[model samples]
Target: MLRTRRVGRGLSMAVCAVLTFSFFTACSRNKTGSSDSITVGVVLPITGREGKPGQYQREGIELAIKQINQNGGILVKDLDKKLPIKEVFYDDTSDQAKSAAFAERAMSSDNVVAVVGAYSTALGEAESVMPDRYQVPWITTGAAASTIFNHGYQYAFGTLSPTNLLGSTTAEYLGTLVDQRKLTKGLKLALALENTDHGVDYGNGIKEWIQQHPGYFVVVFSENFDLGSPDFSGLLQKVKSANADIFLADAHLQDYITMHRQYLQSGMRHLMISYGARGPESDARKALGDGVDYIFAGIWWSRNLPYPQVKKFNEDYKAFTGHEPDSWYPATAYDAMRALAKAIENAGTLNKTAIRDALRKVQLNDSLLPGQTLKFGANGQINTPFVIVQNKPGGKVDIVFPKDAATGDSIAPTPKH
Candidate 1:
């Protein structure tokens, strides 16, 4: 999966990130905290549409705990003892109210000082408010919508990048194709996005990029579709009739799968295709087979990154899960657990306010993100970049953006049916 191609503004940053990403730890002696195991709560969609990614996140958190406990656990300054993490979580089952309710219960009855869970913007936003309400520090592992952090919440932090960037990055990459003469300028584009803050941000980002770089692309069709819509035939038919040269869609996992099936069946061919954060998923590739080939996506994690840490983690992750990783879902959750441990160690006490303060100022170098460093900004969101991945022929997934870190070149004007 490691092929090199440099595109967009992604390569050099990834190059620099590779240089900086390292397994970093803090050496501090502490006491007055829990002498036994520390409790951290998790709330993730385990049985719903978001369940697959949630399961990956859960594995990531659990694996991190196993690794940390094996070493000596986190040292508490006041207690003068190292403590292992004890995770208490409920399957949110992808329900909004349940996510918040489970988060509340975990903090109240489960005795969790902090939480490192929740996936997708909808559920993450639902659980986010409870953290501040309970004075608990919640770090989102999967949510990326900037709106979650825009409300001036102090106790919520996230490891995912912003959605606006997801769209902007995808468009910029397409511009590179035009620059390379692989794609023609003034191409008609169709925009299909989910009806949520995540989708709106993506649409705005793409529009902003197109505005800044005139003559590269023109929006011919745009529509908002609900998540989990069973029939995309009507929408696909519209897209087919639009005579668009490229298609950009923002959807979740299930939507991506459902819509792509309809897209392939509709026989609508585009020079390029993107599914926001939805393409390059393992299940999509398996379900659609070669139909997904050459499809590009703005993704959080790709094993194709030219980093030894990613490679090592991939191997360890497979060993822990007994299955290959579908995407980068686990890394953020793994980093979230590490971040929490670091904050707890630095805080020197189990005090929630102190830990929240610690979280705001915390920085971890050995992160699974493209930027190689995990630090939250004023919005409690990690300002990270993303990689554009292409599902190549022969079941291959490669990073084609940030040419410096790209594992392969993108194939445009995908073969027509």
Candidate 2:
């Protein structure tokens, strides 16, 4: 029998649930009858603070596997035949230690070819080691911190936008607005960011841009808040007291929901507002209603982009999951799976080493991301830029920055609270 454990939510993240691969078979209450299946391991925080997006990543991975199997599965030239993918899903429950352990099990115990997992940088960073130790390729669909790639690991790979760009892009876009006089110069800027590597990178990137471009904005107040906080009144009070002209907060979905509620209630408004990567979520829009409108965010992918394949993917994703994507989480996961499949095909063999080599040389052009291509850099992280999105009234999302790909311009000086 596979062991299981229950964990509680942490300050910045939630609890963890450990479900061994056997649970995947048990969940469906069926046993596989063939050894022809190509096994893959999937670890996710399905029950914690990052659970919502983790579930989204899981759904996206499953959808891609279903499509791949339906289209004749994966070709193994060694056997001159195709094999359907069989996934063993593990619930890391937002526990980093448990995540790595389960990943180790997936490789050492379960005979999986490769692994896909982890929705947050913390968890992804934790599990990054199992790939190289077990000599299996690990593809991370959600983690984006550059630190995960800093270590010399040959087997770890990611499929999301890096944090530096996520922050710098937003800052650059804002600086451009101020340069055009659409926004005031030397405006007071307030920073409320999460206390994590992801948050640190975001803050550092923004601050670096500020240093490079003189006088576009001034950091009047800056502070880091613990993730998963239930209240933000104290923080908002400080920000309001500072009377910053712009407010930038880096947070997760739950934090975004909680803080934004208190922010509006506090009657603190800025010439521009951003919640870092935490804004533009559908749940936030429904929970806060018009409160989220006009709020901008730097994001990985938005369905509103003009990319032809992206448009088609929105339709296919809906059909596959019976729901529209909530945010950029799924798109990255979906593309990651496709990239893996393409690598397997290119390798022409099921040999793990060969596939790993193939991944290094893989370049996917029929992708749904803005870049229109997905290729891992030498450090195993993808080179991609984020888009700026604003939540418009009537539940519509628009691309507001980087005029070349923008669907609409930002509506500044957001309506007074």
Candidate 3:
């Protein structure tokens, strides 16, 4: 009888041990499934000098996220589960110090796998330090300074074309206008740029291009002005006095709108060209009207691309924002999120290091930019083509340069008001 009782007790103990182990295994699996949701962070200047572009960029990111979640979320390989992505965004307010602080906080506290933002070059410079320290991949859609990539950090990626390429593309398109339309011979060019890294990069790019094609361009005046200068009369007068045939100004949207209005009021009538951050903001058009006509800008993307992907994006964007997408700001941010999604899918894991490594290898097949496929270099910089857009009468914008990708004929010498 004693032996029989002992045997029964031992059998019960074994069964309890097996049951406990099985319960824990099930719980562990459930816990991992719960943690599979991926989180991404965005930092943008939603309140200051960079506010307009920031809003555009945020819209793009939101759109991409919507699409991703609608399509059944990101696939996690290790767990064999599909997880939705969660986005956390902060407004940098266009302040450099604030941008840096936000970036640090996002990386450390929010525990984001990747970060996207810093619209201005100054803001980018400030926020870049956090990515390097934390090993989180940082992608910027607005900032275009080459120095950002030159930092030797593998985590920094810029979807927009560098200012150097923008400058050259602008000069090239202008030269075409001069040659084809016989608008001006030996066109004297003047550059009035905001005094910042963006300005310096654009100015240097134009100088390099002019040196390479000397007879085509003659730079009569080159000057840098404060970003928020209220009165551009003095600068416009100098440009007018120089007799420059083409005036190139690199400025942010607000400054672009302000100075261009002032430039018109000052009666300076050279073929106006603004690169880097200029675009067709409704406010600018409402304020300047025909004055903005014929103004050319070199930018990352254009609504004029006839590709189906681009058309869909444009239509969706207009539906959401009640405004057409601008060239650089929104498109780049949209691509950044899509690219991040691709990296996560390819890595099959949420491990930061794996995603970072996979990001380098990820290639986007359905990009909105015409004739531009998305691929990252070792330094995380994207090599993409740019478009030159001319603001036409009746508020029409047409992509003029790069004949192969142009959607409409070039409007040269702009219509006289």
Candidate 4:
């Protein structure tokens, strides 16, 4: 009986050892740090209000990853091998707290070498702190608020130029119209800015330009509105009473659609209308039809850009996504991923610190953005110029500013609706 008991105990020990080995083997396969691939984390508002633009950015990032993997992935010198990227992606659902939490979770739990995400100014602001805290590299694909970079964080980088540039660029474009006699000087401008750092920077940009070049434009009315507000009727009534010749508002995708729909319904018309970086979007067009026409925006990139690489990118993006991008969202996100990839290749290792340092030094000459080069400035934001684009009747969009890149003339003092 003692011998039989010993045999049973031996069998049980052998079974326990096998189970433990299998458990660890399964864990190693599931973990991102597995030797098979390099891991990167992506946190974006894939659902909720910011979902559309965030999805576009995700498409761009995925396209880049697909292309890189097809080319045998990135080379890691330390490993002496090329490994495909394995992404641990999450949806923040456009919640500010979720954005930060997801970023923290990615850095702390996923073992990702780097992360890219949080598409809006507010969301980006929320997630920006995680990079420095976790000692991971973060690249924001969409946020442009200057206040974000002013925090002195070393691990954070962004592809969007400052919102102030977007503002000043809009003012410069409008000033050009005044100089060419397309519009008369001393035009009164009514501003409906979103209540965020983005809006403040935009308002300041226009105000600064007006101060620098007097007699060009005047601010007749200015007001800020909460984001995602349902009704802009009260605001539109005030703007209507302002009697401004030009209407300018810095807004997000949904805000542009909602506000413009109300603007048209209220019969408030201006000589010119702009929604900061929010014109020519397919969703806006689908929402407002001809209502979105004659609107101009100063944006980071356009499919109308005249470059072989830009053309190729557009084609590649379309083939991969089954539809063309209607705004600047995807282009910036695509470049952000490419920039991160280039930095990884330059670092030649998955070391997070090395990747962060390499990001500061790497530059992409084949960038799809204007100037065809992507390089981060001292504050870790790109300083590329914004191109002004206008939507015309029958669904045509054209670049109307910077004569060298202009595909069509600006229809200043827009025709009656």
Candidate 5:
């Protein structure tokens, strides 16, 4: 009887311990659930030609994330919970193949709710296929090609103005300068562009605009060059020989630095040299050192604008990044994050379809760009305004065109280098 009672007591103790362990395990799993964090995947050219801009964009996104988290995270009405954002990043290396692969991985392996990436048009084109296939909403912060929007995919969206709009807006600004300020009349135009979609689209837009206004411009030279050409001396000589009053070049940041340096060194003098979409980069200033003066660029935003929203964003961004925000990339990425948060809140769940549907219906008003309201069209493209900024003496970039929004007067015939 004694032996049997002892055995029974041992069995009872073992059963109690197992039950306690099981109960605690179940409780822990429930407490630390997948709903605790929201994952957002970011893909960018952390290497190659776009490396610098990509780094800038990443920093901006991180700053937005930090600010959002500090504000008590994103609220989920369905779950009645707050979810912190988790960023899963991949380097596309600015390669098309790598971009496609990264997109696949971001969608499948990371299982991210949405993706932000592909700074270049080439990379954007390559990665676009996967998002539609996977039904993931892909927000592009830098790629501005119209083809990205024409693909008829509801899942893809770009925060930047399309190249067509950028090109025409730039030309229109130049026309205003010529007509109102009498900077130059019957201007002779020259075009030099990189051999990429970015170049082609801008070139087409310019051609269309010139065709629309025949007597306003005379095309002296139209040419395209390979990106990252080590020396732009040959190109600069061609541009000089053209002797066009206004020279327009569509190039990336590195190319902008290289070509402009070569232009200044080669003593090319035009009444106006407008660099499309490449002037907001600090690299240009670093490389040229006063060479960038008098050059105008079509941009999406500028810090010098006098507005409460602009001031607040500039101060907050400077506090976070230790530098002022550039034209488009960072602001676009920041807007993307805020838009994503709104979609998540509206959807009330982490379901991709619901989030996408909600995103399509949402209208973003707190954008950094003035007079611009962001709403996704059925085709997943954002319609926004473009601004013109001229680099003034002493490293000041002031908004000179769009008269109603002008921050300073136009400085034309930039002092000869």
Candidate 6:
């Protein structure tokens, strides 16, 4: 009788251990299946010098999220279920340090699968390092500096094409104008660029173009200015003395307004004026009135693009945001979000490594940029063509370059003031 009782007790203990192990295993499976949402992180400057553009980008990201959720979120093959995206958004207040910090917090604390952020080149540079450190994918909607991608980091990507392309495209457009006899060959050019990675790339691109096509242009004057200068009178004086036929500046939106205001006040005029990617902002129009007219910019996206996707995006964006996009800022950002979402779906799981790998293969077929498709190069940057848009009188903007996509005529030689 004693042996029988002892054996029965041992059997009872073994059965309990087995049942406990099975319970935990079952819970693990349910945990994967019952995930409420797939979380993504977003960090952007919503309130500083970069604020206006940043806000537009934020809206673009939010709009894409809304659309994705409306469709029952992304489908994950591992879970055999669809999970809505839960965005963990933060404002870096236009500070580069803060941008990096927020990105770190998102990955370390919020457990985000991916991050999108830091709109400008400088800010993006600050946040770019966080992706590889945390082993999460990051996509920058605005930054175009090539330095960010050359670091051998596998997790970082960008929607904006390299800044050098903007410079080269501008040179190509001007060369065409010279070819058409609208502008003369050997025209002296003046470059006033913002001192940053962006500026360096822009200047190099122009010089490379000039080197390849000798006699098309001459860099009679080239100078760099500190960003957000309270006064540009000193620089403007030097540019005026250069007596160049073309004045090209790579400036942010605010700097464009301030510098142009100073340029107008200083009575400086060039046959052709370009502010890199700054011509069509409504703020510039409001601040400079008729002065901003005839200015051209090589930008990543334009509302003037003639595509069905672009038209739908414009209408949908206006309805969602209660205002039309001021420029190319929002479109790149919107595409960035869509690209990330596509990557997640392609990954078919919330695994960070899988998503990072999948991002390399994502191809957005209905992209709203100059090209209808969006794909990343080996460097994880998009190599889309930049559209050169010129501001016309009475608030009209025209796409003048890449002749096939021209929406309105290029007012070459820009009717000297």
Which residue runs of candidate 3 sit more than 4 Å off their true CA positions? 1-34
Counted clashes in each candidate structure: 16, 3, 0, 0, 0, 0
Distance from true position, residue 72, model 2, in Å?
0.3
Q: Please identify which of the two predictions, 3 or 6, would achieve the higher TM-score against the true structure.
A: 6
Pick the TM-score winner: 4
What TM-score does structure 4 among the candidates reach?
Answer: 0.94
Instruction: Please report how far candidate 3 places residue 215 from its true position, in Å.
Output: 0.5
Worst 10 residues of 3 by lDDT: 27-36
Predictions in order: lDDT: 0.87, 0.86, 0.81, 0.93, 0.81, 0.92
- Candidate 5, 1-417: lDDT as tens digits: 999999999999999999999998776565334677888889988788888778778877887788889988899888899988888889888888998999888887677888987788888889888888998888888888888889788789777778887888888877776677656667888999988888888988887887887767778898999888989888888888887888999988888888888888777788888779877566788778888887888877677766676688788888988987866667777777788888888898888888889889878787766465777777777777787888887888888867778888877766566
Model 6: which ten-residue window has the lowest total lDDT?
25-34
**287-335 in candidate 6: lDDT tens per residue?**
9899999999999999889999888889989999999988998899899
lDDT of 3: 0.81
Instruction: Tell me the lDDT of candidate 2.
Output: 0.86
The TM-score measured for candidate 3 stands at 0.89
Instruction: Give the C-alpha miss distance for residue 270 in model 6, angstroms.
Output: 0.2
Error of 3 at 264 (Å): 0.9
What does candidate 1's lDDT look like per residue over 100-185, in tens digits?
A: 99999887666688988989999998988888888999999999887898899989999888889888899999999999999999
